[model samples]
Target chain A: MSMKRLESRTALVTGGSRGIGAAIVRRLWSEGAKVHFTYRAAEDQAREVIASCGGAVSASALDVTDAVACEAVVDEATEKLGGLDIVVNNAGIIRDGLFLSMEDTDWAEVIETNLGGVFRICRAACRQMLMQGGGSIVNVSSIVGELGGVGQANYAASKGALNALTRSLAAELGPKGVRVNAVAPGMVRTDMTGAVRAVAAEKILERIPLGRFAEPEEIASAVAFLASDDAKYLTGQVVTVDGGLSLLGRR
Target chain B: MQNEKSDILKTVTTVIAQALKVDEAQVQPGSSLIRDLGAESIDFLDIVFRLEKAFKIKIPKGELFPEKLLTDARFVQEGKVTAAGLEELKKRLSGADWTQFEKNPQVSSLGDLFTVGMIVEYLSGKLAATNR
Candidate 1:
């Protein structure tokens, strides 16, 4: 047909080199959105995604934590696509540790890159979103933000702060017609979690009522919903797509 | 714990409560300033200065307020508070009645706390102390 849900939209996804981010970029492009994404140390993966998405998608080498670099990426996207519409903040890094033994460097690095990076990109995108009268922002948080994990103190703190920011951003930008929402994902099969996949997989699977890890596509599906007209009235909400992991305690 | 010193502790507790952005009751001796209260590095710095003014006790410097003190404790490098500084605090306040203040309901801003009057008063006091 004529694309899909996001037709005529110009979108940007940070950390679109691979895994969940790559999946989002592909899905958005399929929906007819002119997509641009950034990747660091994943040049080959970035090129692969751009190749997969064809001419409608553009890939850039940039770090989300660098405010100036993040702005440049947004600027390039808007210039090439004629304007901006949707932004997906999917870039993140994990520095897992127990609170008692965790390193300050690891924690700060994760916070600065994951949480602060979201702030920088969102701040830049909001400027454009405000000027254009409206836009959608989907921040990729994590399931751990809702339920604390041992050895993930840093990750949890960063994600928890992101959830707070999502709410605050919605309040700040809603009056201007811009919507901000967050997606808290469970254990999705991604390259980033490949190391602990096996050991953590069984415990996580048991926690998930569905009894399985999610595919990146599943999380991408929820993101697409939040970024679409279907969720037009929804803002400041965090849609958890962890296959009922969040609800396991009740049942 | 209510006494003249308790009153001083109360004032100090209020300063910690304001700096950590938590209920005064939450600032117990055992309560972690970072983990339990969620204070970050910048917040700890503000708390340090506020503590100095509230208690009028100059912390031993480097030991009590090392820049490394604020790094994330979990990842050591990522967290914002330091072991050396925390240890120094423990030593300084040994046997002191650490009164937890009543948590204020309002979310106070750091920028708001550093008012023109508060800064001028603090500076004047510091100058007088040094001259003495």
Candidate 2:
């Protein structure tokens, strides 16, 4: 916050009304970025996040599943903030089910929102970023992408494809100066993960060497690094922020 | 006609120079985009995107570059472009030179079809068609 690494930078974060996305918005704003964020149906929570930011941060509703809205949000964020320097693709939905009984909607919604939404958002943002000469993009992925969860076949496939998409886009856009990367969180203490923790809190803790779930801020810090010049040389990488849970090899 | 060709070449040279981060003087008419200028597959995508923007024309995928023709089973045998394959390429990309390539026609040499002069000629044709 003191050095203000992101000073003069304008950022847009999706799914920012709660949990990890909220932390990213706060972290970017603290680092001196002009922040704009989106929420699906959390207008109240969005208000609180903006109020808590203690600045002129703006919040809007975006499903991220809507293709046209995905394009519009990027355009709005760029025009409102003057220019876009950073984008965080954090909007994702989880529909965990055993493969045998998983509904078609579960697979379709997870893939469409989590994986396809990133494609749409990045495609739209890349056009603007390319025009601006360069920018940074960070997709909030999950360790389940690398270590597939037993009951999360739909979720797992979505995140795995998301990581691959990140690498592919990085290769395509690197020469143009746009950086693309992903952060695979092990288990962050977020509203989205509340149900998973309620079911297997002790089992999950036993896996992570750190002996606890990550604070949302912990994952946000890693995303902030990738968004800044500190990771300027890096591209096409999946930075795992899982407290060595992945090191345990999915136990 | 001579002045227009020179103008198109100059713009194509600038676009190539910017995309590949090369000196403008190094991108000559006979220079092979990949072999001579060190353009990787990714760099080819960059050059194509920049060319479309600079020329204000949509270069359809696999058109400017004979991507499918190079991969067709009928045209290629043992990694060499067959006589019929050469004919197909000749019919397809009118601006690309086949005079030297006909001598070898190794599938690898297909990249040679994408020369600076070829792109200049291709754009000249595309621009003329659009203007008409």
Candidate 3:
């Protein structure tokens, strides 16, 4: 099938150097959105993604944790694309530790990169979007934020704040023609969860009614929809892609 | 000094109240800022900034808040830290031998704590010193 659904739009995905983020870059490109992505430390991976993607993408070195750097990246992407229409705040990190044992640096770093970084990007994007009439933002939150995980207290709190931030931004920007949403995927097979024990994976799979971890493309497809015209009516929503894990306990 | 302490407590309570969306009276020195008061991390940051502006102080960044207090989600969850405890932590932070504290891995939250009034007082001192 022709995947040109997103033709004529320009998209930027942070953390697009590898794994789920790289998959998102590819999917948006396939759907005909000119794409730009950023990586803090993955120079080779970022270059490789762009090189292999058939020449309509750009990748930059950016540490999303820095508010100034985030604004610059948005500026550069909008400059390259002439104007930006979609932004995917996919860049994040996990500083896992139980709350009791977690270090101050651990909590601050995760909050800075994951939650504060999203705020910086969204703020910059909103300014640009408002000037340009409108845009769409797809922030990548995690299932851990909603369900809460034991060892991922910092990660969960960051993601939880991102969820709240998403709602607040949507409320403020929706009237300006900008749409803000989040995709909270559970147990997606990515480098972020590379160490998941087989037993643990099985346990989670059982919890998911679909009984499997999602491929990166599955999550990317949802992102594409949110960034497209079809989803114009949807804002301030988190479309969970955990295959019913969140619904298992429901009657 | 006692009156000053009361004033600090009242000012800090008002900042916390504004951030927590509660009545100012609900924010007594012993009132729970997080749990009974329902303050989140952002609220903590917000009140910290307000306290700085109100009293004129600069709290150091980078885990300056002691480990124990930082990890206690109960500040928002249980609301258990007493005003006296908060004051003691503040005093300890003032005399904090940064070198000794950094070398010790004992991880006492009392050592790294930074409260609204503490920052307010620090800023006040700085402004006074500069004026001199």
Which one is best on DockQ? 2
* lDDT score for residue A77 of model 3: 95
lDDT measured at residue B97 in model 3 versus the true structure, 0 to 100: 35
CAPRI verdict (incorrect, acceptable, medium, high) for model 3: incorrect
Please give the CA lDDT of all the candidate structures.
0.74, 0.90, 0.76
The full ranking of all candidates by DockQ, starting with the best, is: 2, 3, 1
Distance from true location, Cα of A151 in model 1, Å: 0.7
Docking quality of model 1: it rates as incorrect
The deviation in Å at residue A222 for candidate 1 is 1.0
Q: Candidate 1: RMSD over Cα atoms?
A: 15.2
* Predictions' DockQ, in order: 0.02, 0.20, 0.02
Q: Considering TM-score, where higher is better, how would the candidates rank from best to worst?
A: 2, 1, 3
Worst 10 residues of 3 chain B by lDDT: B104-113
Return the TM-score for candidate 3, rounded to 2 decimals.
0.64
- Model 2's CAPRI class is incorrect
List iRMS (one decimal) for every candidate. 14.2, 3.1, 10.5
